[model samples]
Structure formats: structure tokens, C-alpha cells
Target: MSITAQLRDSVRLPGGDALVNGFAFESRGDGPRRALLESGHELEVHDLVEVFAGERAPTAVFPLPWPGWGRGVHSVSPDGSFAVFSGQRAVRAVSVGGETLWEYRHGCWGPEIGHAHTGDEQEVCRGLEHGSCRVSDDGRLVWAHVVVEPEDQDWQECWVVLDARDGRELARLPLDSAASGSHHLSHPDGIHMGLCIGMGQDGILLHWARWDGAKLTSWDLNETMDRILTDVHTGLPGFLTVEHYGADLRLHALDGAVLAEEAPEPADDEDPPCWDYGCGFVDADTVIASTVESDEDPDRARHWLLDARTLEIRGAVAYPTGPVDSCVRPLGDGTWLTYDDTSETLNRWIEAAS
Candidate 1:
């Protein structure tokens, strides 16, 4: 029988799009997630628990650097004391009081690195490429995927771990990638981080790294295939990834081992149903996967509940209230999140009682 999904709670987004990491840090793994997003050069932070419980009226907001290209991706510290933004030319950390704590400037992510450098917050760049950054679970280090100034007419990108307090460069690893965009997945140990870089039609690049105080050791996983790392399990020994073309979902060990994998079969009169890039472990034993992209008709889009460790299909997820959207963010703690565009609300979900 198909598993039923029920709404647990929801909060309407204040404005703009909200980025949620419900299970980001190990310390606050069980609590509701805190959310932050850029809205016209302003960073809005939401205590999701308070908003959902009707305990707080207004969430926190802070001023941020002006972005000529785009806001790019950003992450807040575990304690919500500050935030770091991977910008067009720099990685900046801003305090909760709207103060610029520190900024690390790098080669321009704009079209031409040789462009005039304004050295101002209002400086504009002309490029669509972006890299991502995330605060470590311990809140002491910030791991960033950034592009460096090129040499010999060749582009160079690197992953750098910086001091979260002083913005000092602690460690850096060069990456051979032309990323359109990328994101970081934090390991529970707080010392390891997984980076997935999207290289447009060139394919995806997956890199795993460990920072042990003095050095940064990195490894390239699946050197040939394009897999997008989506989520990590708190209780399991592996992380989740979907093929770049959504061909299958895989559970990968940190040492570059495939623990398990699942792919869908083609139905009658239909092309093979490929998985969407969005998927994750809802619990140690259960995973939530989607195939929204495989369906041409939105009404028939689907999500499934599978055995997390074995890649066996338990059943397709059933919603009593309505059909959920295609994208899912699994918290890996028996819960996941979805958003309703019409209502502008972020909805949390769990298995329904029989």
C-alpha cells in the first residue's frame, strides 16, 4: 500500500523566496529549521519554529551587499548570529546587527576578470555563474567553493575553508571545474564537506573533502558520471544523490562507495520515468524520491517512499489533502518540506496515521 503524507505545519513566506535547511546543523538537528534568503539586498532570517507555532510576529532582517549579478547562495551560522554570502566577487560575513564583519575578495566572477575593480558594495558584475558556501556544523569554519584569478589564460576554481571568526584563510583546495552553480553538504562530523558542482552540459562534478586543522584532503567521487548530491542522513552511513539527468538515485559513502541505488522503469506508452534532482532520506529506513520531471502533466507528478538502505520501493506517497509540488527537501529526521506557490506558504509533512 502507498504511504500517506499529512501536513504537520506551515508558515507563509514573508516575501521573496526563502531558503530552508531544516536539518543543517547537528546541534539543532531535531528542532525546526531556521531560514534565510535575500530580498532586494536585504537578508531575512526566519525562526521557522516560532512562525509555525504562532509565537513570533516579525522575523529578523539585515542589510546585505548590493549584487550586480545575483544574490548568489548563502548560509547562516548554527546559532543564527550571522550569515555568509557567496557573491559575484567575494565571500562576505555579516553580523545580526547589520554590520559587515568581514569580506574576502577574490577574482571577479563576472564575464571578464580583468574588468575595472570598484571595490565597493555597489559594484556590478556581468556573469551568470555562481559558487556556494556553507557554515560548518560547529560554527567555527566556513567552507566555500569559489573561483580564483586565472593564470596563463586558463580559468581556475578552488574550495576554501576560512576562519569564521576572523575571515582568515585557513585551507584551500584547487578544483578543476567550470561550474554554472554549486552547493555544499555538511557532514555530521563537522570536519567533512561534500561539494557538488553543476557544469552545465559538461556534466556534474562531485568532490568530498576533509579539514583536519592543518590540511585539507579532497577526493573526486565518480570521476566519470554526473551525480548531484542532495542530502545526507544523520543515522545512516551514506548520503543521497540523483543522476544529473535524473536517471537514478544513489546512496554514496564518503569513501566514494555506492551503498545503494534506485531507478524507475518505463511504463506502457510512456518514456522511462527518470527521477528529479530533488530527493533525500526522510528517516533511517525511508527515503522520499520524486519523478515530477518525468511526467509531462503536472497533475500526475509523483513522489515515492523507499527503503533508504536497500533502494527498495515501499510505495508512492499519497496525499489526502492534495498533490504536493514536485520539489522536496527531506530533513532526514522523519520529515520533509514542500512549498505551495498559490498560497505562498512553506508546508512541512510526515507520514499520516492510518
Candidate 2:
């Protein structure tokens, strides 16, 4: 079935440099609502209800440790009270009021191994290799991937769960892999969080962990596949992952068994198609994905809808408003987001009613 995109509302970003990937529930006032990644190192909270009503001002803004170039990843708490940044040498949590609530410093992400001393803060801002963090559903725990010092080892990258109320370390697990960067995907059940570590040409590493108040339990993909874990949802029995180079999309069983696979089947005379690294379930039954990077001509970039369980290509998404400028970020509520880099505007979309 062919699906068309209908615009419900949009807002121009304050900095003209951000996008709304997902949302958070406010602890008060029907919850603060939407979230905007205001550049890689900065995060801004806003009310989607207000943005839909034509107000675009951020309700709260947070300044992160590293600049955008460092490519660190972060996570915002569910209550919108604070955010934790996985910086080059630390995981720091900052309040909505722009105050540093806590910071847990660890081994540097710099290339200079065997160096016991860390350089200036400026050096931390410039490091390229990085890690990621995520706040638990209750906002009481933080899971992070960072370089840590061990008694018998020089330094190693590991995933650790921390006390969200303080910076105290709780439990840790060795990663045994080098990271160019990583991110956490909160599971729909809110109990488990998925970690995706991108190691450039060395391939990708995927992990899942849960902190159950008593101990930390975790597992990994065992380097079984060169896949980028894209989306996880309660509605699906498993999760979705696209191949590292956008070759094919796969839906996997919870135990990592492939349930279905979808690959580009271009017309014989057309160019080979490729999917972007981003793809997610727009709703329980529908998956939205894009081919922006595969298009040599930007104007021809396309988005497609798929059967979430089967990975069957429904068809390319038709945007009546014209070509969408950015890849779609599925909201999992039958809607998604796309930004216009040229205009600095973010748009929310839904399927057009027949």
C-alpha cells in the first residue's frame, strides 16, 4: 500500500541547527513534552503542544561539555529534569536550569595511550572517539559507555550503570571493543536499553543491558553481524536493524534470529538503492525508512513505508508538500519528524487520510 505524508505542524528551530528525534514526558504540567537536539552538544526541551500552536521557544536549554565536532552522545531523563552527556573523558549530568548537577570523570578518549595524566579541558572538547549514555525509565539510573581504568589493565572501554541521584558508580561490564561513537535506545518496556557502538570500518557492536536495582545483567551480539540496530518497540516481538552500509533491512527475533529481510530491488536500468542508517517503527505495524544518502541527486531522495513485522516494502512515501529535506525520525505514534536544513524548520508528519 502506498502511503502519503500530510503535514500537521512545524516550527523553525531557534538556533537553526537542530532536529527533534524523540520526546520526553514532563514530571509536571501534563509533562514538558518534546525534545530537540540543538546541535550535537546541546539539548533543548520544548512543548510539542506549543510548537503545534505556533510557539517555538525552548522551555529549557542545556550546554554540553564537548562541542558538536567531538560527536559525543547523550540522554535526557524522562522527567526533563536533566541530561547526561557522554563526553570525551566523562559523563556529566546538567540540569534544565543549565547547572552541572554531577560529572563522573574517567579515562580520556584521546589517542595518547599510556598517558596517566589528562590534558586540558580544551583537549577533551576536541577528541573524536566517544561513548554514550541513557537515563532509565524511572530517572533513577544512568547507563553509560566510557573509558575506565582497571587495576590490572591500562584502560578499557566499558558500560556502567550509575546512580542518577549522584555520580556514584554502581555496576560495570567490559565492552572489549573500540568505539568511534555509540548511542542508547530505550526499549518500549522501559526495563532494557540497547547500545549501538559504531567502530568505523571495523564494523558495529550492539549490546543490551538492564540494571535491576540489585545487579547489572547484559549481553551482546557477539559480533555476529555487521548491523546497525535501528529501532526497538513493545509492539514487535523483536527489533529492527539495517545492514551497516544500508544494503538491506532486517527484522530480528528477540534472540537475534532473522524474521524478515528487505533489500533494494531497483529496476534493471535504475541505480542500486541504499537505505540510510535511520529507520524505525512509526507505529506498531508500520516502519518508515529513507534512502537520502543513496541518492546522488538530492532532489530524488525518497522515504518508504514497510510492514514492521514482515519488512515488506509498502511503497515510497508521498509528501504532497514536496521533497522532504531530512531523514524521518519515527515518533512511534503514527507520526514522524523531518527537518529542512535550508530553512531551519522542523516538521511533524502523519499519514494522509484517504
Candidate 3:
């Protein structure tokens, strides 16, 4: 598949802020448009034209009272008629043009700042309210993962899922218990929402929850962290691609079933390389991963292509020069969307000749 490049020129903010909370693309005029929100409470809308042309200045800016917490326009309707943002009190829905269409709030702040208390004191959460809102593939329903604190001020962690149309708690899941701390990674498939729950030092867990219009049915993973990574099918029903990684450093299925667990050759210490972030599949048989290598000479990040089914090294290439940040996603075709530190923006590149 071919790819197009885009950049936001003048909207660049100084570094040292938190990582971007979230970003999304929506239809604007004739092509896809993009919006980026910085951790400093600034929002920028990039028209497809300006983005492709790498325009420096944004069309408009909104200074939200987000307290420098996570900010983003998480979901956009399929027809591009509406969008949703993660706000302080509620999930705000806006027209495609960024006008407020509606606001729905289910929970509120307690007496103390950065604290949320439930009606029965059964659950409580601290810090800024962290949650996500994503439109379903059909664009008819929106799923919101609302982060909340446990009321007893214990170490327990929990999140509430709300119905986006009207604020309603569809389901509540215990993310972490007093003895465990958990974090969620959203890997939403068509009708099933898959989340990766890391159980602190204990390891990671994968759960696949089915979202019926009215409620949710979840299945606990019988597998552990070492057997990480799962094959995910996004657009097509039976087309499977691995989208996440867990413990074994090998490939696994969505239910935590071991697909392959062979270990690769150990990385050479003199090679100045170390695995950094996560690994993503390039196809059913291939995976692309990033790493940082530093020794007596210099330290840098690079991308590695490996055989997902064989655990063999396919290729390794020097990452483009710039900051250390990098994100790689493959298109349905053989090409990939590679974002590096160069433009401080995303760019596209075809896989090198093999």
C-alpha cells in the first residue's frame, strides 16, 4: 500500500512536556485531517492540505483548563460529523468543525484535588481523571474508559466504562488490587475490546471483552506475561496480525495461548544495541521492533525486522536522525508508516529492499 506524508509546522511546542496524550484523524474537506494535543493544554487542527504541505501554523488553537494532564480528541464518527475529547468533568463531543455538540458527565471531583470517591466508598482514584473515548467501527456507539480512584485510599485501581451517547456506566472492571497495580493498553478490535493489564512485578494479563450494544462479557486470560503478544484482526474478520507483546518475548494468541515460544540469539554486548520499546507484527509472519544501542562509541535507536513465526532476524537498519522517539505501523499493503524525530512529525517510508 502507498502512503502520504503530513506535518504540522508552526504548531511545534518546546520539548520537556509530557508525551502527547492522544491524536486522531478525521475527514476535512476532501481528505483526512489531523489534530494534536500537547501536554501543556494546547490543541492544533491540521487540514489535510496544510498537513501534507507541512504548514507551520495551526488553523486554530484551544487553551483548555486541563491542568497539564493528558488531553486529546480520542474519537471521530465515521461520517466525520462528530468527535469526542477527554475532559476534566465529562467526555465532550464536538461537531466535525470543532464546535461543542454535547457534554456528558458521570462522575465529579471530591473535596480533595486529584481525588475521586464513589457513592459507597468502595472505589477511589487519585490524580487527574484518566480515561479514553473511542468510536466503534460502525460509529454508532462510543466506548469510554473512565479512570477512577478507590474510595478507601487503598492501592486498589479501577476504571469505569461509560456509554458515550448519554453518560451511563456500562461496566466496571477492577484493574488492580491492593497487592497489584495494573495499566491498560487499548487494542480495540471491531466488536471486541482487548486491553493489556500489567500486574506490576507479578507480570501482565490479557483480557478480551465483547461489547454488545447494552453490556459487556469478558474472559480472563489463563496465560501469564512471559507468553506475551497476540494476533489481532482489525478490518477483516479472519485476517490476523499480532498487535501486542507480553512476557515470553515470543508470539501468542489473543487468549494467551502459546503460538510460538522460541528464543532468539542473544544480542551481542559489543554491538551497542538493546531492545527498547514493544514489538509489532509487520504481517502474520514478520514483526518490526525498535531498540536503543549505546556503548563506547555512540547511542542511537534503530528498527529491527524479525520473523514472528521463526524468531529469526530479518533486517536491522539505523533509525533516521532526530530525537529518540519512534513509532512504526504497517499499512495493509507491504509499506509502513514510520514516524521519527526528524520533522518532530510523522512520515512514510517503504520497507528497504530485501
Cα lDDT, all candidates? 0.77, 0.76, 0.45
- Positional deviation of residue 279's Cα in model 1 after best superposition, in angstroms: 0.5
Per-model TM-score on C-alpha atoms: 0.92, 0.89, 0.63
Q: TM-score of predicted model 2? A: 0.89
lDDT tens digits, residues 1-354, model 3? 211222212233323011221233332122233444443545554443464465656555544334444532355555556656655346677664556666655443213555444554223334333445665556555655443545665333344555655545667676542212222333435566554443345554555566676666776663434222233423222212232332124554555555554332345655434443344455555665554322233344455666666556666644334333454543323333444344455554445443
Ranking by TM-score: 1, 2, 3
Tens digits of per-residue lDDT, candidate 1, 157-243, equal: 999999999789999888888888888888765567889998999899998888888888989985656899887766876678889
Top-TM-score structure, candidate number: 1
Q: After superposition, how far is residue 106 of candidate 1 from its true place, in Å?
A: 0.5
How displaced is residue 69 in candidate 1, in Å? 4.4
Worst 10 contiguous positions by lDDT, candidate 3: 14-23
How high is the lDDT of residue 33 in model 3? 36
User: Which of the two candidates, 1 or 3, achieves a greater lDDT against the reference?
Assistant: 1
Better of 2 and 3 by TM-score: 2
Q: What is candidate 1's local distance difference test score?
A: 0.77
